[model samples]
Target: MSPDLPCIVFVRSFLHKPDNIDHTEHHVRQETPKQIDGHTHRRKHSSDSEKTLTVEDWATSRENPHNWPLAKRVITSLVVYIYTFVVYSGSSMFITAVPLVMQELHLSEQRAMLGLSIYVLGYGVGPLLWGPLSEIPRIGRSVVYFGTFVAFILVTIGAADVSNYSAFIFLRFMQGLFGSPCLANGGASMHDLYPESQFPYTLALWVAAAYCGPALGPLLTNSLVNNISWKWTMWLLACMSGPVCILLFLLPETYAPTIRYRSNAFNTSHNQNNNNTSSQDDNPLAKLKFYLVKPVQITLQDPAILFANIYTSFIYGTYYTFFDAFPIGYPPVYNVSTTTLSLFYLSVLVGCLLAVAAYFTYLSLPNYLRKHHDNTSPKSTPTHTPPTKHERHLIPAIPATFLVPISLFLYGWTLRPSIHWIVSIIGVTMYASAVFIILQCLSMYIPSIYPEYAASLFAANDFCRSTLAAGAVHFGIPLYKNLGMARGSSVLGGVSGLGVLGLLGIYYFGERLRAKSRFVERLVE
Candidate 1:
């Protein structure tokens, strides 16, 4: 719906009492302009206003996407998924371009890979803003999504054109800066659109779509860079944004409170009626402390609280560092073309698909337990035993730990120009798959345990992960070169393997561990 169109403007006015408010179709913009390269063209925005929607609001409101007509909810999920796909694509789109970047910029292989690192830097930092900033009911979601996109597309062009290394890295960071809101909020938006029962599975689908960008980006860019210059790869990637904005223009505001507040306000003013407090008398937000949560406070305080979770930070930071580490070590070891390099992107896909399948399996266990047992309330079922130290989800990180080093060692040691590329690919696949499972576990577990501040928690985690990835990309090549791929990978693999010990410890003692953190404990029960 065009912001100026009657339907778009009418929906923004109160649905129940449109006559009371101004009915004219006006495009009321929000904190951020909503448009980016993939899904929108946006202008910069600034604000921190948002309505607090509790878990109860999620269940009872027919306006919530979970309660909306099935078709409407599906469309909403797809809309979010599309934006994630594009933002992720932008990150890895330069995978095959490292060589071109090296030659064009008069840099070494080590420095050239910084092009990729610079983008990851963006992802790390973006969530701090995008997650909290989009909370406003008044600013509207479309404006937020679209506005950021416009800034993102422009920055991509700038990054491509910048001649100086410092300048190019700066623009790439800006691209990430603008593009990150889509990744950060898209998950929360999905939560808004679906119930907790369906959140894991639906989120799995969204993650899989997000994973597609890393897989497809390298493959697509490899082809583009092979036929032409790396510039075409970015140009083509940015150009794909045109249609996404067209679709976003029609997308409705799915955030329920925004819709409800507008509707109620319209009714109160239109017929000279009473406020929600006077009319409905059952407004949940009446008691909410709305004014104190300024944007700056949210940005600083929320992240500080989340950063206190060492496990979330360590895991996210470690995962992305090693993820990019794979490209740095294996790409040069095998001497493959940009196109062939994309084949290395499969490790995460294999692991991700398994994780996705595992997500459904986890969902099925509860259902199966319900069927076999005499169940009354959904919460009272006793078919399953409580999780034990050994029976933990985080345990998967153990095997993944070994794969990280072992695969890299194998790829590094075996990857001579004379060796077939398949051996190296096997190593990459193993590492990607391992990383994928851990990544999924970290994201899902945090939310599962701390549903209240899941969005903020994710942002804090991204801050750690992105910062580490940026560092790893810059430092990884040197380590691999000095130690050689086998030894370098072995060392990294060992550290990552050591990380597994932490996961195992958590799996075994997580309950006791959760008992230690007030934030975790308070949020859970």
Candidate 2:
């Protein structure tokens, strides 16, 4: 078995034995051979006559997620989408309540801001632990999803009732930590159910849910905070998550390795062999090291990946900073109440919806059909050929890179009493749309480039982005306070403009960078 693959083989002894048999019945362990350069090499077993199951067999089996009924897969996908939304909403749902929390706890603005920043930081850290555990066939994704969510509910309930500043902050971090699995693993779960051709569409919907969750958070809690109390925000999160937890119970295990393992265990029990049991490395400590250490190593060693992560972190930081920036930019200029300001977040949802529509209309569907026709067509040559398959994934990001700076500049300059607030909102919508495109492109493109490290790359991506966003939450208010809206936003816009260069460089030169990467070299070998 390849260590690169997230699978482990085990040997087990059956309890029951035939009365005439003096020897113990041992299960035959099958190791799916690794595929390199489009060729598969199978390992030789002790008994050539013994029936063996291969990875190809598992791929076509009814137990495989891709082989499941359409309705089952759709329902499962919906559950994951909603679960992600509920968890992501927790990060920003408390923004409107910061003032109330400050007043109630007798805290300063910076101290109160920890409620949001600390939670964001927790998301950055939780994935390092959860990402590895979910990859274990014995552990699986469903357990991670259900278990942490229950913990999230408990932490949220505690956060709602806590009065001490320290306890509230601690509970807030716990909320993010416990709620992060969906954010870290949601894409992988979707990948498990769909082929590459169809995955981008599902991922688009998933990304929309993720983006819209925080975007809609303030809107959902605005009325509650204005009418009742800030604590209701936490209570609302708990209430919304409770039913979703029940729905998760109906979600079958989607991780292919876990399903394969279970099926193998059943088969081994029924048909036992006297052949010596073969197994992969089963050391827990070694497994843990691979999961935790590999992602950081890959990110640092691969320049392309590192730059991509940095760009993503900047975009995410700007997005979270908006949570703080909106209050500063909107209320004073528009003379709007908190409730009215919350409505502006809808512009983000509008941007996300627009991006999704455009992705399907222009990119995902057309690319999928093109690939399908190429596969089925009689002629060996196709009319259209992209520069590179992976690079083609980044086409939308080209325009999006320029849009980031343009939108940021427009947003920064337009926040004046003389200017209509709708104009600034158009900037917000543009920024949101650009962010959605850039992130979605990177999310798909990065994994495609490094298929072996997809899970770890995602964990690293989440950690880097969330860590920056956490800092942004802290510094965002102060940036506006000291530099004022126009200057502070220009600073951010200027930083984003650098991403335009970085993205363009990556788009044109990414293949060369990959060819130089030590990690990529290892995969080639």
The residue-by-residue lDDT of candidate 1 on 1-525, one tens digit each, is 122222212121111111111113322221111211123312222231212122333234465455688888888788778878887887778767877777777887767776677887888787766554455445446677888888878877776566677887788788888888777667666655654456556777887787667666777677778787777666866776656666666677765545655555222232232222222222213211211132223334333233334444443444444445556655676665545557667655675676567556655675456444323312412432334322243445557655666765675576666778678667766666666666665665655454434454567666766777677666666776678766766676666555655665555455555655544424111
| Model 2 spans with C-alpha error above 4 angstroms | 1-56, 265-284, 364-386, 521-525
Candidate 2, position 321, lDDT:
85
Tens-place lDDT digits, model 2, residues 1-525 = 121232110000000011001111222234322332233424334454454444344544688676799999999999999999998888889899998888887888888888789988987888877776676666678999999999999999999888777988899999999999888778878877765456778888999998999988999998999899998999999999999999877779987657755667334532343222212222234444555666677777877788888999999899988888898889888899998988998999998898888777765355567577446533323432323556667878889889888888888889899899888888889999999999998887776677555666777788899999999998898999899888988999999999988877776677667777766623222
The superposed Cα distance between candidate 1 and the true structure at residue 18, in angstroms, equals 25
Which run of 10 residues does model 2 get worst, by summed lDDT? Answer: 10-19
lDDT of all predictions = 0.57, 0.75
Clash counts for the predictions, in order: 26, 0
Cα lDDT for residue 367, candidate 1: 47
The lowest-lDDT stretch of 10 consecutive residues in candidate 1 is 13-22
